[model samples]
Target: MSRSPKINTVNEAATKYQAAPNEEYQLVEQAHRGVPAGAFFDILGFSGLTKEELSGLLDVSFKTIQRYQNDGKKLNALNSEQLLKMITLYQKAEDVFGDLVSFNRWLRKPAIGLGNQHPLKYMQTPGGIDLIMDELRRIEFGALA
Candidate 1:
């Protein structure tokens, strides 16, 4: 007998990935408390993103991100905020694409809605995240790309 793939809901994604303590609603508290460096390993490893991408997204140096990972330090408020946004965006992407692999592939592709730019090129900043989320919403609603 064949079995269906297990669905990963947003809450499940958050819990499974340790993306945040209770998803987006609790972000203010989580941001103040800060995210652990290891969370990025979990987040980025599955997403196939490198530390270079993480550093750019967080506006930190690659070495600093490595230092945090080595030291098990909590991310600063700025990075914590960005990390939460990333988690939210990824979870939504997973939902829209119905799988992690498809979403990751889409992230690496050039999108017409994104002006034919590779999504990753713009995804390193907050505005880029918002733009991607808007595109995802459009896709989810069956809008043209």
Candidate 2:
């Protein structure tokens, strides 16, 4: 039986990978207060994205985002979810394209399967993310459009 994808939070991913060799790994039951607000920086580094672009994509203000970084506050549930999703997408893109640069380039161009929409623009919505992921799957299966 195939297991479904677990929509893990940033902290959950960290903890899972950080598990001690002798200990049983445990997934966090909830994300509340588990991830730092500044964890976006990690995602930004992995994705080679700018803070301004991410703020714009997530529809957050620069000053407010600065406060989150300065205060080291925990991201709220919604923001955490978005951050996790973006990281997951980046990882998948890397796996498929072999490098961040290639994946980033592909994200900026209009994809034929995506109705000629730049995949980067679709990162803002869950539905758009699903579409992009579907297109990636098609690419993997040699079903290029």
Candidate 3:
């Protein structure tokens, strides 16, 4: 018996989250426990979103993010939940598109399914993240819409 290598995600914890994504209970629990501030920074870099954009999505100011980083604190529940979802979203996107470059390109381009809006424009809220996930699923299933 041979074991295949695990597909590494951008964030290790987010990979775990993605591994059992169907379990909403697990996701809620992780959200309640909060995520490390560094996780946000890591995802920010990997996500190709500017700090200002990411901060807007996470509902925090740039200074707040810097303060969290300086203090080495965990994010609050709301921010944590959104961050986890965003990380997981990026991981799935990279998987669907085959690479960070491709995914980033898709993110910036307007999609017909999303009313000809850039995906990045919809990443500011949790509901928007869910919408993007649906879009990714559509792409994965050869149902580009």
Candidate 4:
């Protein structure tokens, strides 16, 4: 006879992963709390996403995806493929949730300051600042790339 797979409680998963006491664990805890394997399968089915589909969408190997599901790997940040999917999802969600005008307004506002004090200071260079500026201007306004 085959042994059963281990089913982890939220507290057990959280403790095992040492997840910070924050929103990330809260989301998972809420979703998986008091849920059995059947419920887990039902939720995944409801999303209309197959394991293969999710693997492609996440741009991760199927094994990596399985690791997350079976081994309880914590995906704290979006990978490139996930980030692209999130951008598209956010765009659609915003349309249905009403205009995110206030959010876009911040992006349109002119950035204040130059040099190290500016938010874009990281883009600025300490060595050969004039040369870097020239190259950036050329790339931005000219086809010199």
Backbone Cα, N, C clashes tallied per candidate = 0, 0, 0, 0
Minimal lDDT window, size 10, model 2: 20-29
**Segments of candidate 3 deviating more than 4 angstroms:** 1-20
TM-score on alpha carbons, each prediction: 0.75, 0.74, 0.82, 0.27
| TM-score of model 3 vs. true structure | 0.82
Per-residue lDDT tens digits for candidate 1, residues 1-145, read 2222332345544664356523555775676788777666556655667777777777788778768778778898767766777778887887799877888789888999999998777776756877888989899999986
Off by over 4 Å in 1: 1-13, 16-25
Report clash pairs, candidate 4.
none
lDDT of all predictions, in order shown?
0.72, 0.63, 0.75, 0.33
Weakest 10 consecutive residues of candidate 4 by summed lDDT: 118-127
Model 1, position 43, has a per-residue lDDT of 61
Candidate 2, which segments miss by more than 4 Å at Cα?
A: 1-34
Output the lDDT of residue 125, model 3: 74
Error of 4 at 11 (Å): 22
Arranged by lDDT with the best first, the candidates are 3, 1, 2, 4
Ranking by TM-score: 3, 1, 2, 4
Candidate 2's TM-score: 0.74
Q: What is the C-alpha lDDT profile of model 3 across 31-142, one tens digit per residue?
A: 7887767666667656777788888878798898877767777788878778777877877887888877788888889998898999887887767878898999999999
What lDDT tens digits, residue by residue, belong to model 2 across residues 59-133? 877678767777766666556556655665665676678777888889889999989989989888645766787
